[model samples]
Target: MMEYSDFKFKKMQSQLQEYFDDYFSKEDFLFTLDCDIEDVWNLYLDSFPDEIKGIYHEKPWHDCQRCHLWFKTMANVVMIDDDYKIRTLFDFKTIPEYQDVFRALDEFLKTKRVENLFLHDKHSVGVFRSFAEYDGGFDENHHFYLDLPEKFYEDTENLASELGDALTQRQLFEDTLNLISPDAVDTVLELVHSNSLYRSIQWKDTLEGLKDVFEEFSQLDSNCDLNNWLWKKSANLPRNITHIKNTSMGTLLLDITGGMDLEQAVTNYEKITAPTNYQRPKAIYTAEMLEDAKSKIAELGYMDSLERRFAKLEDISINNVLFANRDVRTTLGEGIFDKLRKNVSRKVYNFDEVSEISLDEFITNVLPHAQEISLHMYPSLKNNFVSLIAPLNEDAPSMFQWDNPYSWTYENNITDSLMKERVKEMGGDVDVDLRFSIQWNDGEWDRNDLDAHSTEPDGNEIFFSRMKSKRTGGWLDVDIIHPEKGKTSVENIQYKHKENMIEGEYLFRVHQYTYRGGDNGFKAEIEFDDTIFSFDYPYKLSNKEYVDVAKVELKDGNFTLTSICDNKVHYLDHAVHWNVALGDFVPVSLICYSPNFWNDNEFGNKHIFFMLKDCINDTNPSGWFNEYLNNELRPHRKVMEAMSSMMRVEDTENQLSGVGFSLGKLGMNKITVKVKTNNIQRIWNVII
Candidate 1:
C-alpha cells in the first residue's frame, strides 16, 4: 500500500536519464524501446536535451483508438495502433477540440523529413514493437498494420478503477497530450501499470523479445556517434534558439539560420533593398477628373473683364461641354471603351498659360483645332467656353448649339392633322366623331383596292361588304375600288353623328383586298371621339393581309388613341417610307432633308423656310411637300439655303453653302417623296 505522492517521479526521472546515457555508451549495440502508448513518449524524450524543439512540440495527440499514429523519420517508418482502445477509459466519448490536433499530426507525419534523428541510426529502430501473439516490430519486407477488437465497458471491467479515474480526469487533461513529446507522463504510467492485460508486452516482449528481435544488431555496423549526434552536430538540433547577431543584417541572418532557403527569403529581401525603375504617368485633367463645372457657371452672374471671362472659361470642364452636345454624347455613350483612341492626352492650359500665347500663335495653333467641332474633344472644349459666357451675352447662341448642328436625324412626321387636311383636299369627308381612312397608289396605278374596316362600340362593323352599320349609323362612305388606272384611290369609314357612337373602345383596321399593282403601300388615318392618329404602311401587304391600325377609347366624351402596331419610330433605319411622284407640282427635284434642323434654331429667328415652288409660303400648305423634313414652313434666308441645297436649286443670294446628295434622281423633272399622308400625289395634282 503505497501513496501516489511518495512514488518519487523525480528520482525515477534521474534514473531514466542515467540509463539513457549508459545505454548510448555501448557503441556496438543499437538499442530500441518497446513500450505501451503511455510510456513510449517519456522514454523517447529522456534521451534528448530539455531545450530540443521539433514539430512534435508544435502539435498535440488526439484520440488514440479512433486515430492511429503513422510516423515517418528519415530512415524509419511505422504505423502504431493502440491495442487498448484509449477512449473507453473516458466512457467511449469523443473530445472534438483534440480532433484538430490529430488532423495536424496525421498531415505532418505523412510528409518526408530529411533531418530527423532516426537518419543518424545505422539500422531501423523498432518503436512500440510487440512480441506477443499480436505481431509487431520492423519488417523490411512489410508495413506494420495491427487490427485489434474494440473493448466495451464489460471487457474493461478489470480496469474499472482506472476507467473511473479517467472519466473524472478527462476535463483536467483536456487537449494536453502531445503525440511526439507527451507531457502527461504520470497519468499515462498509472493507467498502463494498473492494467494487467498489456503487462506481458511491457516485461516479456520489451525486455526479452528485444534480444531475440535484435540478435543480428551487434554483427551490423552500429557506428553512430552518440555525443556528436546529441551535442556537436549543429544541424541536428531544431531551430527554436533565437540569437541576435551584432550586425545590420541580423534579421536576414536569422531567416537563413531558421531553415528559410535562399530563394524564398533572400530573394524578397533583395527586391526590397534594390533600386526601382518604375515612374508614374503625369496627372492630366480628363473629362472625368474635372470638378463640378456646372455649379461654377451657375455661380457667376456676369463677366465684364476679359481676364475674368478667361478665368471662368479655364475653370469650365470638358464633361459639361460633352454632355451639352447630344451628338457627341450619343456617339461616345454607345461603345465608348471600344471607340476611345489610345494616348489621347491633352495638356490643360490655365488662364496665365493661355494669356502668355500671342493671338497669332493661338490662331495658328489653338483656333484651328478648337474650330474642328467634328472631333469629339473639340466640341466639348468649345462648348465649355461658350457656356461660361452664354448667361452674360444675350446675343450669343445657346451653350452647345454651335454651327446649328442637328441634335437628331430624320423620322416619319406625318400626323393625323396632315392626313385630315390631305383627305379634305382629296374631296373625302373628315368631319365626324370617328373616321378610318386608307389611300394608296403605285404611280403606274392599276385597279388595286385596299379596304378600311372599323368595328363600332356596339360591335357592328363597317367595310366594303357591309358599307353601313345599321345599329350604330357608322358608314364606310368612300370605298374606292380604283376602277380607273391613273389615280390614287381612297377608302373612308366615318361615324358622322355623336348619338350613333357608343361609350367603349372602337377598333380600326385596314385589309389589302386585291393585289393588282407593283406598289402595295398605303396610309391609314384614325379619328374617334375627337382624338386622331395616322400610320403609313410602306411595305407591300399580301392579299387579304390585315393591318390593325389603332384602338380608340371613348368614355364620358373623352377620347384616347392607342396604336395597335409599334408605329412610333426610334431609329430611321426601321421607319416606313412612302414614295409619291409629284410630276408637275413643283419646278425642283428633291434630295434628303434634315428633320432636326429646327432643334438648333435660336428663338425669334425664323430658322427654317422652304418654298414648295408653287407651294404657299405659310405654316399650312397644299400639295405633297417635304412636311416631315421642314417641320415649320416659314420664310428665312437659312431655310432658303437649306431648301435650295436639298432641292438642288441654285440659291444665288446665299451661294448654296450647305451640302446635299441626290435622293434617287435629284436631277429629274419628276420629284418623288416618301409621303405619309393619304393620296399626297392627288393633292399635288389638284393644287397645280
Candidate 2:
C-alpha cells in the first residue's frame, strides 16, 4: 500500500484532475483543494462528507449489512428496476462521508460535462446518470483517490505548504481526494476494477423493485445545495447565493476563490461586510434670501405708513369741521342753534366775532332741535354716535343724551307720582265695565237716566271715566255722583206685569240728576195678577228673586226723593196689550199701572191702546200669537184673511202667522163671556 504522504497526495491529486478533465469541460467544473486541517475537516463534515464515506467504508467491508442493503436498494431502484440507464455507485457503507464528497463532485462535474456534450454533439442528452449513494462512515471513506490533472497536484502542494504540517496525513489524503472531481474518471472503469463493482452496477439497475419495500436509510441532507444548478439563470442570484452560502454552504464564493472552503469563506465575508450605523445631515439656510425677504417687508411697512397718512387726511376733510362745514361731525356737533347763531354773526359781523359764541350756548338752544331733526333723518347715526362716544371719559354733554330726542324731565312730585301710579295701575290687572240706559215718562214727569260704573273703580274718577267712555258711547258731559255722596240716591225699585204674574227689582236711582220739580222723578210701579201676559213676562235682573209689587214713586221736588214701601193701594201693574179678532176671545190679561183704572187712568189706557196698535199693525206676527189665536177662535173668514195677509202665505192657503192651518167644520155651541168696561168704551162680541 502507498503510505499516505505529501508526494503520494500530489500524485493522487494529479490523476484525479486528469480523470475529471477527460469527462468534464473546464468552465463547468468547480475545483477546490483546501489543505488546512480545519478546512479539510469542515469540507468532510459540511459540504460532501457522504461521498467521502462511500468511497472508503462501503468499498472495504459489509459489516453493516443494512447500510449495504440501503445502498443496493437505491442503486437498483434508480437504475435496473426503473430501467434508468444511469451510472450510480453504492459505496456509502464503506465510506459514507467520502460518498457525500464524491456525490457533490460528481454533480458539479456532470453539469460541466452536460454543457460540453451539448455543445459538441447537439443530439447528446448529456450525462443522463449522475448520483452517488452513501451509507455511513466518514474517516476511512473520505480519503478515496480519483484521477486529477498535474496543475491540481501543483495547487494541492502549494495549499498544503500554506496550511503547514500540523494536519494529519489521513486528513491531507482525504482533502486531496475531495479536490478531484468525481466525474474525472470513467465510472464504468472503476466499477469493473473493484471486487463488488459489477454487483454495484447490477444492483443499481434492479433497486427499483426493492424501493417500495425498503426502508430508506440515507435521508437527503437538507444542508446540501441540491438545486444550485437550477438557480444559475435567476436575476436574484446574488441574494439567493448569499443566502445559500450563509445557511447551506457555510462559506462565501469570494473566500472560496481565495483558496478557502465554502464554509470558512462565508464566515469571513459576513465578518468583513457587516452593516454600520447611519448618520443624519444638518439643515442650512441662505442669508441672501433672508435679507431679500426683510427688504420686501420694510417696503411694505413704508407703503402702509403712506396709506395711513392718506386715510387720516381723508378723514379730516370728510369728518372735521375745519375742512368741511357740512361734514358729519361739524353739522351734527354745531347743531341748528349754532348754525343760526353763526349765520346771524356772519351777517352782522365777521368770522372772528361769530367764533366768539360759546359752544355751550350754541348747543343748548340749537343742538336739541338739530338732534330732533337728525332723529327723523338719520336715526341710526344718533344711536351709533351715542354708543361710540358714551364710553369716552371726556365730558361732552351733547353726547350724553343725544340718542333720545323725546326724553323729558318730570319736575314736580305730584305729576311724577301721578304718572307712575297710572302706569302701575294700568299694568296691575285687566277690568271691564258694562253700562245701560233706562228711560220712562209719567203724566207730569219725563226722565232719562244713564248709569256708568266699573267693578274696579280704584277711587280714580278720571281713570274710570276715560275707561268708561272708551267702552260705552262718547264722553259723558253730565255730572256723576257716587252712592256714598248725598248728591245721588239709590232706591230698590221693582217692576211687575199683572197679566204675566212675573216681577223683578233693581237698585235704581238717577245716575245724574238735574233740578226739575213737579213730578220729574223716575218712578217704577210693579203689580202681579193671574192669566200671565206672554209678551210682558219679567226677566231676572242678576239672580232669581221676584220683586214686590208695590209701586216705587220718585218725586223731584226741591231734590230727587225716592220712596220704597209696600202699600197695596199704591201698587199697580203695567198694561200688557194684545189684539184679537172680532169674534175671537183672547182670555184678556193686562200688565198695567193701575188695577182699578182710577189713579193714572189716562196713562194706563194710552199704554194699552198703543201696545194694542203695535200688536195689530206688526206685519211679521210671531208664531206664539198664532197658536194662541188659532186655538181660541174657531176659524172665521175675517180672521183667516187677516192672518194669511200678515204671514204673507199663498192665497190658496190659510196660515196663522207663518204656520198653515185649516178649518174642517164648526161645532154649534153657545158661549157666554163677562167683560170689563173703562171710561172710554165697553163692548162684547158673542158667537153662537
Give each model a TM-score: 0.24, 0.13
Estimate, for each residue in 289-403, the C-alpha lDDT of model 1 and write its tens digit: 1233223323432121101110121222232221112222342242432233222333333322113333234323332222111111111111011101112222322222232
lDDT of the structure predicted as candidate 1: 0.34
Top candidate, metric TM-score: 1
**Steric overlap count per candidate:** 1, 69
lDDT (Cα atoms) of all candidates against the true structure = 0.34, 0.24
Candidate 2 TM-score, true structure as reference: 0.13
Q: Model 2 — which ten-residue stretch has the worst lDDT?
A: 380-389
- Candidate 1 positional error at 102, Å: 99
In candidate 2, what are the lDDT values of residues 452-536, reduced to their tens digit?
A: 2212112222122453323222222222232221122212111111222111222222233323232333333121121111111
